[model samples]
Target chain A: MAASKCTSLSGALTRQLLDSVDSVLFDCDGVIWRGDQAIPRAPEVINSLKKNGKRVFFVTNNSTKTRQMYADKLGKLGFDATADEVFGTAYCSAMYLKNVCKLDGKVYLIGSNAMKQELEEVGIQPVGVGPDPISGVQIDWANVPLDKEVRAVLVGFDEHFSYMKLNRALQYLCNPDCQFVGTNTDTRLPLEGGKAVPGTGCLLRAVETAAQRQAQVVGKPSSFMFECVASQFDLDPQKCLMVGDRLDTDIMLGSNCGMKTLLTLTGVSTVAEAEANLKSECPHRQRMVPDYYVDSIADILPALQA
Target chain B: MAASKCTSLSGALTRQLLDSVDSVLFDCDGVIWRGDQAIPRAPEVINSLKKNGKRVFFVTNNSTKTRQMYADKLGKLGFDATADEVFGTAYCSAMYLKNVCKLDGKVYLIGSNAMKQELEEVGIQPVGVGPDPISGVQIDWANVPLDKEVRAVLVGFDEHFSYMKLNRALQYLCNPDCQFVGTNTDTRLPLEGGKAVPGTGCLLRAVETAAQRQAQVVGKPSSFMFECVASQFDLDPQKCLMVGDRLDTDIMLGSNCGMKTLLTLTGVSTVAEAEANLKSECPHRQRMVPDYYVDSIADILPALQA
Candidate 1:
């Protein structure tokens, strides 16, 4: 942990790191806030960064919310934000289908209405949201009427994921040409009281195992989410800094997309873990190390002060 | 592919192979019956073998049926099958927990009520059989009340498998001591019209990935099912001739349990698959090759009739 590896100090080096970045990307729920509560002075730090003419953007793997919902939450949390600046997996996934995959048919979406709304916003019709009930009898489960027009299967956070849906996804994906897309491969969702639940990764793996195929992930660490931000804002990677608390998702995404990374330790991962990773022999683990470390996003407020 | 490998012919070599075994194990679907119809003269062949003092038993990886249910199906299809003669994975899994794993606590079963019935028959109280509804809000998925009595998590053919159940299983399995067991890892269940649905293996792999641990599977190819049959019948594995349809599940189970295997083509796999495995360079695939090939279980009829 050298002083040079930290960009929080009010000095020439810290100012230089800040001066080189015109675009600022933030990961929600950890770096800016934890759960329902906003991190102390995090909103102020973000507002200050925006005031300095830095294009502040929110990059989240959370597929459960639409852009409008994320904008509403940001407004309520006292963070000066807009829907256009938010790059959620839900919106990015839809954007990915449109801009990158260039799919012509509807999406066999195994996600939520929020994701459906996002996909529909981009003119990509998403089918198979909500509950797909099972027919108690053993009538050829593989024979579920598949929509021939579905050219892709988009996986996200679905609360109603079931055997029927998983089977249908597998059946549809049997076509080698059918595209498979995932929101993110987050293994667990951390809850209050140190509890956790299965995330999109669990559902995605189930379908992958059954279908025997891989999904093109459109979330953090995949470069798709960052690409969404970069393509939309026309921001240069060298001039953009990604700030998040998680090393695997947010920080890895920054490094993966050739952008500077700032790790704030107000949420999941700790400094000790990052230091160990930096010294690890495994190249994959080493890549997850951030360019800089901070105790909290609030630490950056001092560097931005007059 | 050679005539010498054919066991259907009434020759000296065929008779010698049959004479070497005093016990006979038969797979249910595609071996004795196809869907709801009994294969012509298959039941007659089994009756003749039983009349000749050969120990007859039914072995299957289908976890959907209980022993009693299987016996009823067998009776309806013209086979004289007792509950003791049937060793479905549903029953064998419960037996594996009771005998092999020596589990003393209640089981968190992610399967049907038939599995629960089998567990109860073995005096092992099974919980978590039906739907586990989510709280809708994503506040605390990990905080779902876990039962201390739950000592093992058994995965089987569960139609009601949901995110909440999977999360709860992961939460409970987070305990290092909790045993993880799967009935079988059959990837797909073939239905009428050549349609297929995901089997227990898909569900099992999902849990295995989330828990980051392997489950001790108690179905075909694991030898646990044959061990159950042998322990119940007091028969030697060397003296048993296992008859099956699928090369992977049934024939492999036979090979793993040190029993001679006979493959019939009325089910999932074809003779070309068996022949390919027989000549496979990989020893793992070679082990799945059956000792003899028959066109159908009816191929054994003339041997039994004479």
Candidate 2:
């Protein structure tokens, strides 16, 4: 019935799936690379897909890197990619604030310098980027000098995230008119080994807890990410295939956008997890199940070569 | 007819309510004082309660100060109080880790020097109290040297709360055996002139988000704070009157512990809000509805005088 969902992408099925979609959107980190090292044959798969007259785009939730930085990293890893082909949260969030929110004033940014650069690229001013060391008493913090023009608070991956920054954001958010936006809700940034570090979600949660307000997230699973790419390239969702390692973010985003989804076993989620989602009664979990699963993005190499 | 819930405490009702409870637990900050100033005649009300042969105790969610500091503040405010008669999150959290969790190992404390002293007083060694400044890459952070003896992570109101602290907690909590504890979940610490600063809740939330585990909270509404006081003083919950300003923490704690709850108007929650909780069909909201409402804790003075 319907060729069975979450099937193994192999042989004729891989070729058939490739022919169905004109463009492939790949999630970074686990799908194409682990850390500094690229997954074996993942570069070949991406380059071959481009050579085969199919479009390829790299979409990542990591806000520490801008589009240009991502392109530079991709090139260093031997991947044939361009800055325009990358859609990171840093760039998309700025676009969202400018285009969707039509934010005219400055942003009280609790994020990296990359985010500041992205916001600047879009002609939006961002205040509070670096370490805002706590100096005064609680009353002093409550009365911390705030930028009068700051109309929004943007939370992302900030290495310098501190109590002062959190307090600043809360003070800005006390005015109900201030817009709150977050990059993504990924809890942990999985590294090369079993080791990991806290992600943007932690900082954002801290800010949310203080402000007593939920932030509008711009990363995966939200339609804005897919729409950001589609709007620029005029790409059709139905003719796009989303390949990712994570079921919750990448595959869920594909499902939300009505695009075909393929799960790669090289990342945070497993095939068993996808199957568990398939068998789950929850409609939300069901949306996370991919149409197909591959051992790695390298698995698509034979189909691309053919 | 039965007395209506959330009724205004005035005239004979005040005296009758006062005679009903043998002990009175007062919340600091909004209840007894606003910043450095006492709430009009709140100290007189507290001293009068003690003079009238009612045992009085001060319970606060603030983790910054030790019991001695609270007692000192109470004395300065003209309230008849002692260090033994005060229960704060700083002292309560230390008790929770030592007595409840039966923690025998060192703790990674994301709190203040007061918390450090409390932990030391309880014979539990705590490390990482001050600013753990960030240095090195993400991988370096993931592998940041962790104390092998640290078996618990305690979060409170840390002005030095940083990304490094959050990451360190995540690393410690990665060990499933490590205990996670928080002082309270009060989002804002209200200051004078309607200003506020981020509370312990924000810092604790970040750690929880990163750890992917809920902390054992030791403040208002958790029952631990009341139990800590009652166990030592041999006070009966039924004969205890929990008087406070906020409905969520103070009133909810009183209701949770089966004590009489009074909502005072001199603080965060309003009379209309308590009335709204009374009208709401939610069971949790119902718990938040205080049995009686008073214009101020000063209103009880006339009743005590009688």
Candidate 3:
């Protein structure tokens, strides 16, 4: 299809869009809250969507937080969300590898315990392969033996990562059949004080360039994440609306999966910036322009009522 | 020509190869000492080459260390060297921007004091644009107000980098005429106590990908670094033998500049690994084949005497 032109949807048109969608996927970071504080009218818009019989699901590429943690944060922000109503990249990554990739082999995971637990819950065993692990062999940089059985490489944000771990991971990726997977490609992670180190995306790119291989990213921007969500919730992509702040991840995810994406100016990107980027020749530019633009979630109530 | 089929050269052949070379360039990190520990017999091999009436220069992509620092390290490791004998990426980068690119205007330098000093020496005024500058303009991340006066973007290793710094760099690169220059592309830097962090190369790749613009890398692997050395020392590329452990940076530099490359099995890459990479279908694979493969620098002493 040709690039979708930006149409200034009237109040009537906004109401039509709101009423037509059966499922609404909300990006947690920018759409709901800016860091910790809730964005203006976030709770009201979400409550209104729920009242109108919409299945509200909080979806995020931030693998640092678990579903329960997201639910707790949402409940505290007055959005009235349950643990089951939230989905994250960690969840989708585990599901994709289990279902689509059909990878039942040994996986060298490089994330938190939450990622490990999620993989286990899906009948897949997760093993840490850097220095210390429970079951599988750990490739200690101080003493890297170069194990031959390592079949796959899975990466996420691990604060305890060492050079030896990275070197061993590169060795594993050197093998042709070894699959490379990542939970998400978020460059920056939100910290309590300020933004800390970038996520696994940076490291993944290094390995990808060195090995000359493209990794199968199972997070946002990958249709697999949305497919997993739709399969679990029984929601049709055509009738779903994805609300997000970041253009690369959340917005691209919605567009790639054939879902309507609403760009909120409250998070990582602004409308003017998005418009300028849309004019650029970036491959992901066309996939970024959202179906609708809004200043904040509070504007959603009036548009839905109209 | 014809991929230089004679790999394992005899003693007389090695002497002939050395005699044919007027100058020799070596990469410091993987080629010589990898973070203080000299590769076995590297110093001896270099000394032997010097005794054979060949001018030897240390050309490295390591921008973090200045020429004086390299000289000190080499001196301690039994290789008699002075500051003039060593050429770093910082030196070549400054030369390229000043002479080739003709960037005489103000530059926002994203590196250390050594790099800044080099740029200033080359008549390019260094300006700080990041949030915290020890002695330059504070880098403004959100809105990089780049006027027409800005000539180039000089990137190096900065430990105290922020997202805003990267964002501003991208903004500067967005300008069609703005020259994007990087000191090197080494992904990680070796730290004290066996630790490593993302280096300037990692940051450079991020900006390069976002801007969709290739950076003119002034460090190792680039023929520009070798060109700077050859011009400064009045040497010829055809008579020069570039000796380094890593094939990508050292060997590629020699190959691109029409010099003989020697691959050692001491640092980051192994002999088997380099052979596999040399035979790969990758475009970089055809750069330079090692004229000779040996376990350490000690192997070169006998050949030089013969």
Candidate 4:
């Protein structure tokens, strides 16, 4: 089976692979959708999977949206997904702090309003959302008032990410006891027409550089995202099929969780890159090799129908 | 000499060390002054070094202030310093672009007014200084109007560092032909009373992560800085003494240039830290160990008087 890694999914093999898993985990961007538009036949593939008694879930590293927001977007896109069936970094990071770290204090958040809502939903108070414009001078910034209750620094997708916010996070993180967590490490968020904006990873890198500390990431490729889903739904990793367009995040997450991994070609990575990873001598790159790949998620529609 | 590293400099040893060097380079922040206040007896040390026929220069990683601004600050603090004697990243970065890269077009700058002034001083045009607040959406950012004339993306100390600025840099850097340069890699700007703020390195790291490329650094430890000083002054590296507070930047820069190195305790590093570097088996750590350690730059006052 190891020797047959990164094989193309088609005809009989697609059905055989689908039958082996009781659940299918789909990465939101690129796998099932790109930006605001859904991928062709992605909805049918996901809907048919659920109709066949296979549970479907949307797992994404994007931290800008809450579970409910994802569910709303999914429903609008005809994915038939509920808020309970959605797992994004915003929700997963909240779960990681609540369940894994068992954090009792407030979080100094460098993220979005959706993240704030998600953290609040999990009974974790998050401070420092929205625009934190620079004021005074370097001395004022270094001595910026910090919340005594902030026991952790949470970094995610922030449009208003500024030097002041970076400084604030550094001040909080300077306390050795203060926990540091990041949503993901995806450097750029690819948009339509091959354009890309700096992703949460860029912001996270800046904060990590400033704090001089590594963040406990709670996004794709970190077992925590899979664990967040498994703990809630009692998922068997062996009976789950992880589908994503990015080999580094989605396929790597699948590989990390001991799940059957499928790479859809509607997004970031390509077949040549996957083959290169499979042929690589490095252990880390080898893990990024998916079990199977398709031109797009729509390729799985015929398999689901059969 | 290889066996004796990080020795305490005082008494007759200080005079002997002074006699060995015809030129002395001082790091501004912790070695000469802390924030707005000049270190006690620091001015005397610089003046005395000049009085004894040894050339004096200030080399700093700080990119926020222009050479004139630094000279004004030095004059206000009672130091006999001139604008031409300063070798800050702002000025050195301009020199790097004009001389080394030989940039023929305008620069997309992610830095301060000081950097802009320095670039202009070197007959180079610079764009994108001051506040570049976020507008529209992510797609708008990725498609932000790029100046076709921009041949390079230069990053330095930006108090206005934001996600938008980071995005703009990524867009310019997406063009492989566009050169990338960073002023320094200093992560934190240590302030008075043990407080600190995020430095240009944090901003540079964020852009590097987003652009998926390494930047050509123009600051300390990168021999370009020493070369910039040596070219105009015709310095002999062996006859120059480099004194600074931080071992990683200042002392390492001296070592890289084959100059006599002195680590002053009144700044970011300590004698204990220098000792640890000396004991380390790593070649990189060995280079960080200074030839001598001092309580402060003021300790050289007695040697100058003698």
Candidate 5:
């Protein structure tokens, strides 16, 4: 393992950092763009990584978008990427059910159709995707129809997340044998104008509190996500670099996988926040602080050119 | 205050316990009935309380039922109850908003029509009652249509609870002055056949997590509900007895309001659970232990007859 030598991420040291890793994993949304518009020079930097023979992968917790959708979005944004190189939670969670849990029965999924498509792509059947609308009274909810074939419950980002879906998920989770898997434990989803909404973690926790069970999160911060990438690409965790905007998820995932972490200030956390986490009494919080931080992912564009 | 000499409630002790408090508050579900059927002689015991000149009040965390609804249910079940004597969180929360918070503005309620009716009874208007359906994309959910007049976010049991409602409630709660109040913090509602459904606590916690704020809960274990009954009936907390099946809500509320607590075996908690709490090192948990435990509320019926 390369011992981190500096807290500062800039200039000639940035070039040395870029040269140190053969593979680079990037977190979408905040690092690359705020929304539709691309972050300044981010695309150029990503393109440069590919040009330099660095294995690049876009790892995101966004379960709403399919791999193909992400690939098309990246292509349109002028980044050198493909569907196989993008590992979204929707896809990885499906792979997790197939590879890790080895689930032979159907999954009671409380998520989007994109998740369903991903599960089907991996030859796994997923039920309860779209709106699980309230058909009867609240009392009827107690006797909610359960599928015996449902051996697992996978929770992700669902725009149509309703009480019916939540109840059904809770019912499925009550079984001790049923595997509980969550796409990510993101508490809040930050939006364009400094506004945020409850993330998948809120729904997962709701069901957890109701059912008294914990879920195995398959998103960043969990080593399972990094393992998915590593085992698939035959990449060594020690030689890979993870660049992300969030400290808890992206940087923590990198650190957990024994990879070097780079924090970009385009999203959720700031340098002061990272410093606080680094100095935190809790070992878990301290583990979340990045080894290095850049003003933006675009800061590496000049270094990559050099 | 009578010093409790024995943990067991029966025979001579039951009569003595009944003679102690002038005001008797009952938790409906477990103590009264498992579901539809009445728990043994619960009705006769309640009726006997009123006949003996004791002020009886039906206190419940269940917010789906309005005061009139609770009264009708009680009447059907053969309890001596009136709309005025029944205080569900729906009614208490509404009262809390009006008399306590002195809320003059509209409430953004994520509950049922029962909650709306209760809020209206107290001359407080409530909006966003049913579903806050999402018409746009998930990202559009960040900028949900907000009502500036909404000074409070009162959450209760709504069957039509959705992500849209959760987001809107969270948006309303983002305002520091916007009072957040939950009907109850019950994690799950157990049914007759060992089945259960996610309770309002899940929804309230989800919103609380997303908004990064704490709600002023008005349910049992909270003194606000007791104050609602106390201020209205001109009763002293010391002269009241709280009878409940659940130790966390009912017995805890009794302890909180400086009243005697009686735990009945017909509900969620057991005598063993109460003993564990009584022996717990945590003072809060210890306070939740009941002053007495009855095999059934019906035990008091025999005492009433004697």
Candidate 6:
């Protein structure tokens, strides 16, 4: 039912509306914390949802941090969350490579140890540098040598990267038949101290220019992460609520997957900025629009009740 | 003074004919080799200059290589050149810091080792990570622990670089009194195999955005290099000849410094391109017209002897 009739309702009405959601998906990073600082009412919102019997899950395109790590961060921030409540790009990447790519060869890994572990859990052998002594095509570069038998290039962020590695990746991509796959093309990664750093997007662009090839990005905006989420929770897309701060990611993902989207301005975006952007010409203009806009979780209660 | 009049001289005979200069300064990268491969007719023209008793020197904004290195590369390419014939940005950079800025603090070298050697020779101490106890502003990280007691920020090409170093440099630059300097702003550097890589210009931009500050470029367009050339060689500007492939750099530098300029079509700029650009409105419009335009150095001989 439309909750607009409950304009004068208080926290009780907000809880009642949240209880109606069978599945709730929250975007990590901005939605939870601006880098590492928790939003003012994030814990209260999560706790309220839990008390009202809502199934909550944290979703993120950040392949750097593991699911357990996200849960631990949330737990420390006064929000109770478990590993099962977290879903990350690393998990989705592994699933895509295993089910979609049909793995019979050694995989090259460019992300953190968590991604490597996730890939191995799916029965895919992970390699970094080398001539895969025995291989069909190289999947990612963990320790993989440039001259190694690379059949495909997989991209992710690696802090210890060099131009030499980028050059080799370009050389590999020069092969017409070789494929280029990126986990995601996120431009910035949240660092420890509220600072952001250039992520895989920068590296991907370097390779793209050098190779004169485009990569098939497999996470977020691709609908693959949502599909993974649906399958993991065994829920229909229409019944899920997607909550995030960024319109391009959260709202677009939800809209594309046929789910309801809510945009919070407490993260990277503000309501005024989103409104201004809505007036601009954007390619994804029609595909994504937030069903609700709130300044923070505290504001969310009034909006939900209204 | 303008050599014997030829049938080629059709219009504007009333214009004063200035005596031609004997010494010629040629820019290396764009003027001769576009990275690793020599532009068409570049070697032949350079060789012809020597045969015609025209004193020639290769001046480059690239601080990565030493004079001997440039000499070796030119010799391998069938061009006869001594170490003394090559002058790089490193020399001018060190000269500026030592004489103009009067900077005596330990510099955190951020360019090539050759640049470090040049700074050290100029009595500017180099400090960075690994064993060296550093205190002062980071002058460059072309080489890394880019973090130090940097009182100034100096930028140059360092292929093995990360955003972390750039971020730290930006932090140093946040101090209003801290000096920011760059060796050059060439967007792309030529690779050995016709490929291009992001050069120091890209690095400088990253820091510029982070610090919201513009850097004092010390190479090419700065006029400092040209001033150094004029004083060191004891040559009058009106009697000096600047020959380069790019009109924006070589020719513009010449015009700005009151020297005669020659633009060759064999390098970065083509005759058609120059014609098109000449029609545009620019701040340097008066300086746009070259004193001479020729297909190559081979063409210069006939024109000079006319």
Go through the candidates in order and give the C-alpha RMSD of each one to the true structure. Answer: 3.0, 1.2, 7.7, 1.3, 1.7, 8.1
**Residue-wise lDDT of candidate 6 within B40-144, one digit each (tens)?**
666776777677676777878887877778889999887878887777887777887788888857665566677777788788875442212222222222123
For candidate 4 chain B, which ten residues in a row score worst on lDDT? B1-10
lDDT of 1 by residue, A1-306 (tens): 223443343356556778889989999987888888899998999899988888999999999999999999999999999999999999999999998899999999999999999999989998999888777666657677899999999999998888888999988998999999999998777765666677898899888878878999999899988888888789899999999889999889988988888888887888888888888899898768888878888877867875
Instruction: Kindly report the docking quality category of candidate 3.
Output: incorrect
TM-score, cand. 3: 0.68
Report lDDT (CA) for all predictions: 0.86, 0.93, 0.71, 0.92, 0.87, 0.66
lDDT of 2 by residue, A181-218 (tens): 99999999999879999999999998998899999999
Model 4 residue runs over 4 Å out of place are A1-3, B1-3
Ordered from best to worst DockQ, the candidate numbers read 2, 4, 5, 1, 3, 6
Residues B123-241 of candidate 5 have per-residue lDDT tens digits of 99999987666668757787877888999999898888898998898788878889988889998888876788999888887778778788899998899989999989998887888
lDDT, candidate 4, at A68: 94
Tens digits of per-residue lDDT, candidate 6, A1-306, equal 433210222356445546556788988777767666788778777776776567888888877777777888899998988987787877777788877776556565655677777777788766563211221112222233554555667777655444445545665665676667778776555444344555566556555655667887776777888887778779777678788887777877887897766777666655565555556677576445666665665655443324
Give the CAPRI rating of model 6. incorrect
Model 3: per-residue Cα lDDT over B1-306, one tens digit each: 224531754567667777778887877766677666777777877887777677889887767667777788899999967888888877778889988898868776777677777777778887763334212212223244555677788888754343344555656766788888989888755443534444567667655654557888888787788878888888878888888877778877877888877776656656676667668788777664566666755666787766
Ranking by lDDT: 2, 4, 5, 1, 3, 6
Off by over 4 Å in 1: A1-13, B1-11, B275-280
In the range B68-155, model 4's lDDT, one tens digit per residue, is 9999999999999999999999999999999999999999999999999999998999999988899898878888999999999999
Q: Could you tell me how far off, in angstroms, the CA of residue A290 lies in candidate 5 after the best superposition?
A: 1.3
Q: Which ranking of candidates, highest TM-score first? A: 2, 4, 5, 1, 3, 6
Model 3 residue B150 lDDT? 74
**Whole-model lDDT, model 6:** 0.66
Could you tell me how far off, in angstroms, the CA of residue A90 lies in candidate 2 after the best superposition?
A: 1.0
TM-score per candidate, chains pooled: 0.92, 0.98, 0.68, 0.98, 0.97, 0.66
* Clash count per candidate: 0, 0, 6, 0, 0, 28
Clashes of 4: 0
